[model samples]
Target: MLNLKQIVAGYGPAQVLHGVSLDVPRGRVSALLGANGAGKTTLMRVLAGLVRPQSGSVEHEGREITALPAPRRVGLGIAMSPEGRMVFPTLTVEENLQLGAIHARARRGYRERREEMYALFPRLAERRRQTAGSMSGGEQQMLAIARALMARPDVLLLDEPTLGLAPVMVKQIFEVVQRLKEGGLTMFIAEQNVRQTLEIADHAYVLENGRVQLEGSGAALINDAGVRRAYLGM
Candidate 1:
C-alpha cells in the first residue's frame, strides 16, 4: 500500500539514505533488517513525513505523498511507533493515546477510537490512568503502539519495538505483531532482530550502508548467504 522510490534523506547535510526504494504491499508486514546506521530509522521517518527527502517519491495506494507533512500523513492513514517508544512520560497512558487522535481530521469520534485502542490492548485498559514513565519498557512500547492505533491507522510503522526488552517481553511484543498481521494491518518494521522480524513478515529488505542491498520473501532472506554472513551470523 506504500511505495518509496529512491528515497534520499538525511539530517541536515549528511545524507543517510541513498536511493532506498522498497514497497509495502497492502495488508502485509514488511520488515527492513539492518544493523545500526543502516538508515532503517531514517526510512521510517521519511515515510512518516518526519524527515524530508532530498530527491525521491513516496506514494500511498497509487497517489504521491512525497510532500505531505506529518499530520497529513497521519490523516492519510500512516502512524508511527518510534524506536524509543517516545511515550509522554509525564502523562497517563490513556492521555497519551488520546493525544495521538488530535490530528485535525480525527477530532470526531476520538472517544470512540480511544475505546477501540483500549480494546485492542486489554492490558492498556487496566493501566489507562497510570503514568507512562512508571510502566515497564515493554508496557511503554505497548503504549506507543496503542497510541499509534488510536489514530485508527491503515498502516503502522514500527521502529525497534523490542529494543532492550526482556526475552518474555520480546515474545509478547512479537505476538502482538502477529495478531496485527492476522487482522490485516499493513506494517513496515525496522528491526534488529532479523529472525523474529523475518518470521512475522511476508517480505523483507536488507539495508546496508544506507541503501537497499537485497530484497526478497522473508523466508528466502533468512537463508540468503550474505544475510547469514552479516546479519544472521550463520
Candidate 2:
C-alpha cells in the first residue's frame, strides 16, 4: 500500500499540484481521471520520486519515502511505466528489459522476472531481439509495461498506457491491466480514457486544477451524473 498526503509539487516556481492527497491500497487499482493539465501526471511523478513534493509525505506500506530519489523508489519496489510508452527505441526488447533490472534489488531473480514478463506479453518474447523502435505502438506499450515488470515491483504506476493507440490496442492494454489486477498487482494509473479506466479501477479520484475534485468507488463514478457529463459525455 502507498499513501500520498497533502502533496504539493510543481516545476520550478509555478506550482502544479496543490495539497493533493490520495491512497493506493494493496492489490487494488487506483485511478486518477482528468483532462490534460489536471495534474494527473504530476501526481504520478511525485509518487515515482521523479518530482519531489514541496510539502507532504509519500509512504509505502508505512515507510515514508518522500525524499527518496527515483532509483531509490525503484529499489523500494515501485516501478513506473511512463506515458507515451517511452521504451528505449534503439535497444532490443531484451536489452531494454535488462536495464530495468539493473538495480541490485531487481537483479537477483532477473531471469525469472524476465520470463514472467515474456509470459505476460508473448509478443515481447517473439520480439526479444528486435529493436523497440520498429514495433507498433501497441507492441511498444506492451514492451513498456513488460519492461517495468522486469523490476519485480510491488506497486506499479502507469501513466497514460493507452494515450494514442487504436481502439483494439486500447482494449488489449485494458485486458493486460485486468490480468495484472487479478494477479494482485497494486497499480496507480493516470488516464484520460474515463469509461474504460473506471470499469477496471477499484477506486478513483477525479482531479481538477491540481486537486481532487471528486473521489469514490469506480463503479459509483461510472454511474455518477457529473462524471458521465464531464468525462464520458453520456
Candidate 3:
C-alpha cells in the first residue's frame, strides 16, 4: 500500500500541491481524476521520488520514503510510466525493456520476466528488434508500460497513459489496466478519461486546484451528480 499525507510540492516559488492526502490500498487500482494543472502529475512524481515534497510524507507499506531518490524508489517496487511515454527513440524494443531492469531484484530473472511482458503484449514481441521511435503512438505507449513492468514493481504509477491516443487505442490501454488489476497489481493512475477510468478503478479521487475535492468508491463517484455533470458530461 502507498500513502501520502499533507504533501506540498512546487517548482521554486510556484506551488502546485497544497495539503494533498490519499491512500492506495494493496492490490487495487486507485484513480486520480483531475483536469490539467490539478497537480495530478506532480503527485505522481512525488510518489516516484522524482520530486521531493516540501512538507508531509510518502510511505509505502509503512516505511517512510519521503527523502528517497528515484532509483531507490524503483528498488522499493515503485515504477512510473510517465505522461508522455518517454521511450528511447534509438533503442530497440527489447533494449528499452532491458533498461527497465535496473534494480537487482528485477534483473534476477530478467529473461523470464521479459517473456512475460512479451506474452502480455504480443505486439511488442513481434517488433522486438524495431526501434522505438519507428513505432506508432499506441505501440510506443504499450512499450512504455511494458518497460515499467520490466522493473517488476509492486505499485505502478501511470500518469495519463491514454493521453492523445486514438479512442480504440485508449480502450486497448484500459483493457490492459483491467487485466493488471485482475492480476492484483497495485496501481495509482492519474487520468483525465473519467468514465473509463472509474469503470476499471476500485477507488477514485478527484483533484481540483492541487487539492483533493472528492474521494470515494469508483462507482459512487461515477454516479455522483456533480461528477456526472462535470466529468461525464451528462
Q: Best-fitting candidate, measured by lDDT?
A: 3
Please tell me which predicted candidate would have the highest TM-score against the true structure: 3
Question: Of the candidates numbered 1 and 3, which has the greater lDDT value?
Answer: 3
Please give, for residues 111-145, the per-residue lDDT of candidate 3 as tens digits: 99999999988999999999999999999999999
RMSD in order of candidates:
1.3, 0.8, 0.7
TM-score of 2: 0.98
Residues 41-130 of candidate 2: C-alpha lDDT, one tens digit per residue: 889899999998999999989999999999989988999999888999999999999998998888998999999889889999999999
The lDDT, on a scale of 0 to 1, for candidate 2 is 0.94
Q: How large an RMSD does model 3 have?
A: 0.7
The estimated TM-scores of all candidates read 0.96, 0.98, 0.99
Full candidate order by TM-score, most accurate first: 3, 2, 1
The deviation in Å at residue 141 for candidate 2 is: 0.6
TM-score of 1: 0.96
All candidates' lDDT scores?
Answer: 0.91, 0.94, 0.95
Two-way TM-score contest, 2 vs 3, winner:
3
The regions of model 1 sitting more than 4 angstroms off are none
